[model samples]
Target: MSTTRLFNVYCDESCHLQHDGVPVMAWGAVYCQATETRAIAQAVRALKTQHGLSPAFEVKWTKVSPAKAAFYLALVDMFLADHRLRFRGLVVPDKGVLDHDRFDQSHDDWYYKMYYTMLRPIFCAPHRYRIYLDVKDTRGGPKTRKLHEVLANSLYDFDRKCIERVQQVRSHESELLPIADILIGALTYSNRGLASNSAKRAIVARLGERLGSTALTRTSTFATTKFNILLWQSREALG
Candidate 1:
């Protein structure tokens, strides 16, 4: 660790492909001071052990089921109760409406712009940051490097002192990335009107209740720190 204060940011996204057919594409991130990462992960492992899961067992939104609903709920509560952790999310309500071709931009280009936009509110300048993204594909290595370059250039972090590193790590290796998955999944699922899973609905309701909102689709209240959501609208949608 560096001598200066550092923040660790973990990010994950759902249904990001241009042709995924999913109506909503979402990105969520959780960040905290670098010193809290180990402690938070250890606490999460402890919670898993309490649920009779092996400490090494990975927690993921895909694994949320009626049988494991209690465990997932507890994890959600844990995240909300922890003041050290902060979450920021962005949702494209309808990916099909995006017109990257008309804008003379590639999907990758727009994706990076959205990524930067989602992260802008949470970033604290004059402090170092280390960002970890869930590995989506082996082919994204170049994209990951480009993300670092783009973010650094935009922030004017020439020596990369402000944004130290941005890299992809397997979700199973991270405790926070899975939380991002679960949270973003809930937002996307609700906004898509997907009511197929009762367990998911219950979790979403509980989360909304906790945030004093009936739905997680809108922007979060400014007073809220644990969960801040942004519902992205296309230029056409605005028009």
Candidate 2:
């Protein structure tokens, strides 16, 4: 690991759309020093091997099952315990409440706004970042580019210097990305009140328990590196 002072942000979203028939929308990211990424991926591969699952298997929230409860739980434990890895989630409790028309912004613009909310708190001037987003389809590339522009505008990085690059990559290609998927899935699931999968329900419960609160739908004003969740609103809360 070099002393390059580089950071990597792995971003992903869950149930993000205007009308997905789901009430909640979540965009989240996992942050770590750039140098630690390889080590983290290797550790996750080892964990998969420990569970007797293929290291190549793509881990996702839907994969949670009673048969592999221990494996998922251990993965949660690893994220919580690892000092280098940090999690931040931005959840829209009710998408129906968002009136983009009233705000005079398009849905696409709002999408970038939520992404910026999910990222702004972690940006620092001295350190540069490379943001990797999970590829969902052809739209993924365009969305990634638009997000970079919005981020640069908000950061006042006119030269596009602070944010080194924004990219789209396959989920299986990056180990830490699935972590974002799993965490965001737990968040959206808990908010949506889905309990069909007892194993997933338990895994989400473990996440809430680790963060020392059950009311994850409410924003945590003061959060540490272990787990920080910001439940955002389209409008400002009354003071």
Q: TM-score each candidate.
A: 0.95, 0.94
Q: What is the Cα-based lDDT of residue 205 in candidate 2?
A: 85
TM-score computed on alpha carbons, candidate 2 = 0.94
lDDT per residue for candidate 2 within 170-219, as digits (tens), equals: 99999999999999998999888889998898888888787765646677
List model 1 lDDT by residue over 72-148, tens digit each. Answer: 99999999899999899999988988888899999999999989988877776567899999998877799889989
> Clashes per prediction?
0, 0
Q: Judged by lDDT against the true structure, how good is candidate 1?
A: 0.88
> Which run of 10 residues does model 1 get worst, by summed lDDT?
213-222
Q: What's the lDDT for candidate 2?
A: 0.88
C-alpha RMSD by candidate, in order: 2.2, 2.2
The local distance difference test score of each candidate is 0.88, 0.88
Largest TM-score belongs to which candidate? 1
Runs off by more than 4 Å, candidate 2: 1-4, 236-239
Q: Output the lDDT of residue 130, model 2.
A: 95
